[model samples]
Target: MEKVIKSSDRVKDHGEVFTPKRIVNLMLDQPEIQSKINDLQATFFEPSAGEGAFLVELLKRKLKVAKNKSVSAKLFNTKSLLALSTLYGIELLEDNVEMLVMNMITTFNIEYSNIIQEKFGGKVNQHVFDSAKVIIQANMVQGNTLEKITSDGSPIIFSEWKPVSGNKVQRTEYTFESIINQSGPTGTVQGATEEMDLFADTDFFADLQKKEPRMKKYALCGWTSIYKQEIV
Candidate 1:
């Protein structure tokens, strides 16, 4: 039998309890939820993703859809990554977050290898694996979901990967809070103005101009190369 609780201390402190596989399947079996699982691009976010049990099952279903829609190795690679990109999660405990990432990566790689052997009859693509790693790492983050911030108090950021054309994707970053508030991306911006020199020969009025925060967008790149962040 699977161990659902790690320890009594964890249970008391964080209420950490893993859902049983049977229960997870039954819950996901509902008609409306199963319909979304069949969509290769439908995004799913688990606010309390302990060890990623739900996300893993979701990935498995999406991978099946990807396989059904693919007729070649290249098409399989593209669709499988697209499926991987749609699953996101947040785990409060660091240990659970580590396990969550591991489980997700393992499940995805195993499915990839299986498809390659059964359908493609060739070596699995390393680029595809690397890209999946990038997606999993970005989508699954260790944070307090209710607070919308990471353990260190910084805002949690998630990347949005949009397939633009062919195998190319456009990447955009959005803070968890911004996403919840429907505001916008909290992008990399220049630091606040340097300490006012009061005595330095400077254009006082020019120095007073507020530095607008610029939102940066990654240039469109092949889905297999998303690990490299190239700004536009």
Candidate 2:
């Protein structure tokens, strides 16, 4: 077992072993998985992103592709969003979670800086960096995946970020259970009464609207611009 944490007591308690870099790379080198390493729209999920070993490699590969496709900051940021936003991870320990976020955003900023200097004559907007940080913060979380509950005891929920027209992004939140039910091998939303209805497909918004929380939907602008400070 690879011991990432120095404390043996904590390791015993949390089983916090991290996969070594060599193993991680070997596993990701499989032809099918390697093919999509730089595919901007492809998604990645790491259950325990300890210091983001695998995730960092993913960012490196994706940013390499983005660097190649750098025509302008606008086009590059829009495409880079797909690569950055599609990554998701859940870490039980808060420190691990924070580290994972740091790992991701730092890699993002460094890569963005490198590519801009190499291809775009070092002229780029700060908003692009802000956008990457925002996406990384939202994507990684500290939570118990087995329990599938947020810290507040609510069902785990993840937001989907979609790039809309006019350089804006649309965010849609969905319950973890709902997402699995929709995509599971069962190939059907066939489940108990607590589950979302398959019949609700046609009237999706109506059902979603009637729900207690009123499905969280938001549109974020300012992505078209360069980052000055923070995410709006």
Candidate 3:
């Protein structure tokens, strides 16, 4: 005969899961938000990006706006694709981060490729491929929210990221150069040069404030829920 287990002996699980797309839409579609869209610079931060559902929708909306305005196809195409530059996300789980990154790349590639074909008559080369790759990679960053620190020193953000499973915690610093290096010389080709200057500036705090003076005095903690949690 088997004995029944007591409630005290059982552990409750609160598994991390992706946010539903419908819920994400509702949050983004609030009337107050709709009115503020034009005045705002379009930058977005998702503390828990889980599979990038919200990001994908945001991109679609930006693209629609560009297309409807009769903007130059080249400028609109680049702008639509560059909208990814406004996105930022963090995931606690490595697997989840990888999944989100892959999805982001695939989604952006589909739109970017279509734009290229429509504009350039089916041209396929390193420039187009590299541009698409750069946009996708820039939008998604993989790191634990708990282990990051904001520009200000109020509270430590992303301080809980752990790459290894052990008693001692290890921190990993990732840079654009590191990632490009790992790509193993695939980016270098005669007449296929791409500037690395864009990746050199990783300080979002300075870049954002410079573009919009209203954002100058805003604390870094106000930018995302993760930092808000840290300050509180």
The Cα local distance difference test for each model comes to: 0.85, 0.69, 0.46
Over 5-87, each residue of candidate 2 has an lDDT whose tens digit, in order, gives 65888689988777787888898889888778757767888877778889988888887776667677667767676677778
RMSD of 1: 6.0
Query: Whose lDDT is higher: candidate 2's or candidate 3's?
Result: 2
lDDT of 3 by residue, 1-232 (tens): 2222223323132145445677768977987655534322356667767667787777656555544542454444444433544566765555666778787767666765665467545443444345445445534556544534222211111111221232112222232222324532222221112311346656655544332212111112211111122221
Candidate 1 lDDT at 130 equals: 91
| TM-scores of all predicted structures | 0.86, 0.77, 0.50
Please give the lDDT score at residue 178 for candidate 1.
Answer: 68
Evaluated with lDDT, which candidate comes out highest?
Answer: 1
| TM-score, prediction 2 | 0.77
lDDT of 1 by residue, 110-200 (tens): 9989997898886798989998998999899999999776786556788898988778898888877668878766643213344446576
Worst 10 residues of 3 by lDDT: 215-224
* Residue pairs that clash (backbone atoms under 3 angstroms), model 3: 145-158, 146-158, 146-159, 146-160, 147-158, 147-159, 147-160, 148-157, 148-158
At residue 172, candidate 3 shows an lDDT of 24
- Runs of candidate 3 with Cα error greater than 4 angstroms are 1-15, 35-40, 114-129, 149-232
lDDT at position 208, candidate 3: 40
